[model samples]
Target: MNDFLELVKSRQSDRTYDTTRAVEPEKLERILEAARLAPSACNAQPWKFVVVTDKELSNKVGKATSGLGMNKFAKDAPVHILVVEESANITSLLGGKVKNKHFPLIDLGIAAAHITLAAESEGLGSCILGWFDEKEIKSLTGIPASKRLVLVITIGYSAKAKRQKMRKEKAKVISYNKY
Candidate 1:
């Protein structure tokens, strides 16, 4: 497989992370760099990332991310990245209104994809978590009340082994010119 294709194939949501292992600073930097380069609507770049490395804080954020048994594995990860949604630039905002879509959310998703791929490339495990207490996380992270808390990505070395990828048949999901 091509390098990028191989990376994509290998990447999966890692729920079991080794608590003893710490991600290297250099690798973390590269992952963040990849996220920073993610494409955004009209280059508006309406996202802010908060990386939590402190054990206590990571635990707090992780616990907050887990609501009603959801994302219970997050507390074990060594790092948690908060993807905050910021105001888009004027052009992107206008385009979003005209297109009847919120471009910032799309932009944030793209950024999160980049981050997960990069973490995989760096031999780190990652899981993008959305089932979190938005208001609690915002307060815990000291994120401005006006900003949107979009995603929380847990990262660390995997304690569990990689499993085979399961998916629908390509033919079933793909289409020709018309759906």
Candidate 2:
């Protein structure tokens, strides 16, 4: 398999992480660099990443997560990544007429894909979390009204590297020529 392909296959969602095993600065930098390179609409690139490394802050934010599993699972990871996208930044590029749905969230999703793959390549583990209240998250992060939080991610080295996640046989999902 190609290196990139292997990286993709190797990635898995690990709910358990080793808080004692801190991710190196260089590794984190590479992950951030990868996310920074993801493409955006008209280069609007309205996303901003706020990494919470402070344990107290991480736990505080974790508590705001609505899912019981999320609150319990969050503390084990060493860092939390807040994925935020600003509507104002997007509106500038989109111009008149704020559509029923804005595209910054989509753009943020693209960047998040980059981040997850990058973390895998760096031998780090991550869980993409999204069970938190928007208002609570905004208040916790002191984020502006224009910026909406799209997702949160807990990142660090996993307690154990579980085997690869098996997908449904590709034949079932793939279509030839047309679906």
Summarize candidate 1's per-residue lDDT along 1-179 as a digit string, tens digits. 59999999999999999999999989999999999999999999999999999899899999999978799999899999999999999999999999999999999999999999999999999999989998888888899998889999999999988999999999999999988
Error of model 2, residue 144, in angstroms: 2.0
> Model-by-model lDDT, in order?
0.94, 0.79
Backbone clash pairs for candidate 2 read none
Model 2 alpha-carbon drift over 4 Å, by segment? 66-68, 88-101
* Most accurate candidate by TM-score: 1
Candidates in order, TM-scores: namely 0.98, 0.86
Which candidate's lDDT is highest?
A: 1
Clash count for each candidate, listed in order shown: 0, 0
Query: Which ten contiguous residues of candidate 1 have the minimum total lDDT?
Result: 133-142
lDDT of 2 by residue, 53-158 (tens): 7878877777676465555777667778899875445454565245555566678888988998889888888878778877877888898867778898888898
